[model samples]
Target chain A: MRVVKKAEDRKNEILDAVDELFGQKGFDGTSTNDILEKVGIARGTLYHHFKSKEDIMDALIDRYAVRLIDGAQEVAADKSIPIVERIIRVVMALNLSGGSSEQIMEHIHKPQNALMHQKIQKVIINGVPPILTEIIREGIQQGLFSTPFPYECMEMVVIYASTVFDDDLVVMTEKERSSRIVAFVCNVERLLGAESGSLMDVMGMFGEGDESSRD
Target chain B: MRVVKKAEDRKNEILDAVDELFGQKGFDGTSTNDILEKVGIARGTLYHHFKSKEDIMDALIDRYAVRLIDGAQEVAADKSIPIVERIIRVVMALNLSGGSSEQIMEHIHKPQNALMHQKIQKVIINGVPPILTEIIREGIQQGLFSTPFPYECMEMVVIYASTVFDDDLVVMTEKERSSRIVAFVCNVERLLGAESGSLMDVMGMFGEGDESSRD
Candidate 1:
């Protein structure tokens, strides 16, 4: 029996297999043969979809960026959630920890994957701010926050959080990490002009055993 | 007549020559032979002082880090300068723009010299905060600023400014840059719990025709 799949479907199937393979064996460790065997695709089919392993990695990065932004956007658009909680929720949505993404996280964290790590940071620095900014504007309108440079404020905060907490850049002990998180939330309140302690609840999202805080 | 030179003098002469060559031709464009010819040193002497181009770069980065920290410390320790003004000066001392360092700045800004750029950033991130934190602590005592996390606050600000204003990272128009500077000062005031607009004078240091602002 011959089973036919569309080009898009075939492409996605390859990506799906490569994602798992890359996560398991890493981008460098996994060979094209591993991908072919995993996807049950011919060499020609894989080449048809992606010119090279680098191309496949680039495609995977694009998919991850979309997934991350879409998740945050959905949370940002939820009027039902309070503005402050929505802000926290939107940030939480962007965390790539737990479940299937865990392996992906580990893969990118490897020293050999610095380029991939940088690409993800670039995506967050550029993409996440706009999504987070819209929520900030809503907070400003409701008088829950005050800032003329909502977007810039978000940009600064995102840039700081991304760099400081980056395990690759600045390593911290457990005690130091906790203290930094507390300070991060405190300073964030000041940046948005929110009342102190209002955003302290966001700290719970970073607490131990908290699934969202794993990253 | 053979000129007798100390090991430190010989090493510094080599560094000075390579620094100029690197600025003019870039790191990759400049070769060991050029360094040797310019410094008038034999291959054995050059190898004795440094094993490779990368070792020389590491040595240069260490020198830069010390120069930066020492300059900032001098300004920071001066009691004549007001606390707020002192804070601004300490930051300005860390700027690598203008004069002899100008060519060095241009060299590191090239794409191929990203590793060199990253090393400099690491130095700033790790080294600058402690110097600024002492100043912030003074501000806290004088009630000019208030923060439980003075060091953490400075770390956040430094990390943000370094990454955002980093030429290789975020690109902005002149207008956008001006606005971001304003926002940065505003947020810095908020982060430190200082009075609004107190830090606005720092803006002059970043204005057009201002040498310090060239960066």
Candidate 2:
């Protein structure tokens, strides 16, 4: 019996194969023939789904964004979690560095892939802010936070976190990293008008050794 | 009497022409021939100073960095200005979106010049934090700020400002822009552990029309 996959599933299968190939061989090293041979798809079929290799990379980025957004949305929707904890969890869940996300980041940073990098940045910058804003708004209603500029606050937070935590963007020593985590949480507490030290528990999650309050 | 220029003066003259040409015609549009014609230099002299257009661009970036650093240093050294106002002035002096700075930014953002963009970003991410840190340290001594992580705080501040205020990175509606200005000042106060409204004067510089507190 032939296992007939739906068009969407077939498309996803191609993406998964290329994602692995890109990880192993990088964007420039991976050839279309490699993809076709790995996926066992005719050249026409592959072309039917994607115009070119770059198109395939775009699809992979979209797939990655969807997964990230879904993970963040799940944490945002968990009413059982406290509001501040929920925000921290949402941030942790969106850390796209350890696994396939790292590979995607590498691929986009290639000089020829500048456009792809821009597109992914647009997704994170424009898309992630609203999702975080929803959580911030929830905190505002509960009086755990208070800010009429919820959207802008979340935008500022996302921009700061994305840049500081983005290993590709800026490298930091262990001391610098730990210190930043402290500064980050301190400002975040003040940004939301939460009581001082309310968000300091985030340092524990970040494994920051120095927990001394800035006196 | 013929005014004989030294080698250094000739180099500066060529740089001035290429800078204006790159500003008017971009990195790609202006050719070596255009630079030669504009500067009235023989091909040998041009090649003697710069091997390629990219090398010329590197020189230009170096010059830009020096100018920016000098401007920020002057502001940082001026003890007459208040500490909070000094930070704001230093940031304003580093604005890369007007005059020659704007041209350099446009040239770097071109797709073919991704390497140039990365090089410039490296300068900003690594070079900028320490310069801002000096001012932050001054603020700490004056009892205007209370932060143990002064360098990290400055890093965070630069990353946020460079991204949000970078016209190329993120686009905001006019209202969104105004709100971000307010939010930026608000968080900066908290990050430095200054009084709640201590840095609100930055809003006046930014022409923030809507000063309503984000309650």
Candidate 3:
């Protein structure tokens, strides 16, 4: 008996299989036949869901963008967290890791998948600033920060951090990386008009340890 | 009778021809045969200088990088200019405009030439910061600015400016662009610990007029 699955479930099954296949074999290495065999789906079904492997990659990117922005929005909405810590948490939430995401990150990091990498960066540059801007506005109201252009300020900060600290873009030694983090935090403090050392705690997040361990 | 030319001169002649051709026809639109015909060089000579059209484009990028950095360095080295004004001039010099450059910019801005755009951005990100850092150090000694991480600070600033203001990356209305400039100048003051309004003059340079007319 053929498995009768809903269209949504069937689409996700294909995506899930492709996601693992992409992670293991990399996007270019994984063939459409590989995806079809892994999902036990006919070529027609696969075509129905995705036009091509690149289409599947685009879908994965969309899913990741949604997951990332939703995670950040959740953190941003949590008022119980202090504004500073909340901002840090929001940034931390944007880090793509854990389980398949690690593999996905590796896949995108491959030189061949530069377009994928650019797409992800484009998502972050366009998406994250507004989420963080809401928190910044609160900080301004609390008299903890001051900026007339909260959105633009965060856009600049996000663009800078994402680009300069990208391992692919600039290679940094341990010493250089640490110093850059220090400078980053310092400049962020200045950008937000926060008191000096107020955002210094952010340095801990960049330390050579897991976020949970730091916590 | 055979005419002889120096290897260096022949390479430049090829480059100069391709530069104009690329400006008129774009990187993708121009071809090897076109370059050969335009330069009036045999295919053998063209291959001697550049293995391929991509190789020629790489050479053009290097030439542009040197021209941009050297121009910025000259402005940065000028002691007669005030620290604030010099910063503006150094940034202004980095703008890729003027005859062939304007066309080069348009060519790189095309979607198909993204890798070329990325390369040019990498040059500016890596090259401009060091040149500006020297000026920032002078500012520190002159009591006009203070930052322990002058190099890192300039890196972040250049990366942000180059990425955000990039026409391909983010689209902004005229009003939005003006406001971003205001915020950028404001934040740069905070980043360098300069007094407020000291960098306001930088805004005039970004207005909707040529730098010479502004002066």
Question: Which stretches in model 3 have alpha-carbon errors above 4 Å?
Answer: A1-57, A95-103, A205-215, B1-56, B96-103, B205-215
Per-candidate local distance difference test:
0.77, 0.72, 0.77
What is candidate 2's TM-score for chain A?
0.80
| C-alpha-based local distance difference test score of model 1 | 0.77
lDDT of 3 by residue, B19-98 (tens): 78876777767888998888787788889878887789899999988877777788788899888888876775565332
TM-score of each: 0.78, 0.76, 0.81
Local accuracy of candidate 3 as per-residue lDDT tens digits, A9-75: 9988988987788767776678899988999978898998778767888898898888777777888
Tens digits of lDDT, candidate 2, A1-215: 33467889989999999988876776667899999899988788899889888899889889878877777787788889887777877776554332334544555555434455555666777778888898888888888887767787777778777766754667778786766777778877776788878788754644433223322
The better-scoring model by lDDT among 1 and 2 is 1
Top candidate by DockQ: 3
Q: List the residue pairs that clash in candidate 3.
A: none
Candidate 2, chain B, TM-score (2 decimals): 0.81
lDDT of 1 at B70: 74
Runs of candidate 1 exceeding 4 Å displacement? A1-60, A95-116, A205-215, B1-54, B95-103, B205-215
Error of 3 at A81 (Å): 1.6
Least accurate 10 contiguous residues by lDDT in model 1 chain A: A95-104
Fnat (0 to 1) per candidate: 0.49, 0.60, 0.51
User: Regarding TM-score, does 1 or 3 come out ahead?
Assistant: 3
Tens digits of per-residue lDDT, candidate 2, B1-215, equal 33357878887888899878876766667899999898887788889878887788788778877776666777788989878877887776565332234545555555434445555665777777788898888888889888877777777777777767763567788787767777877877877888878889654754433233322
DockQ of 2: 0.39
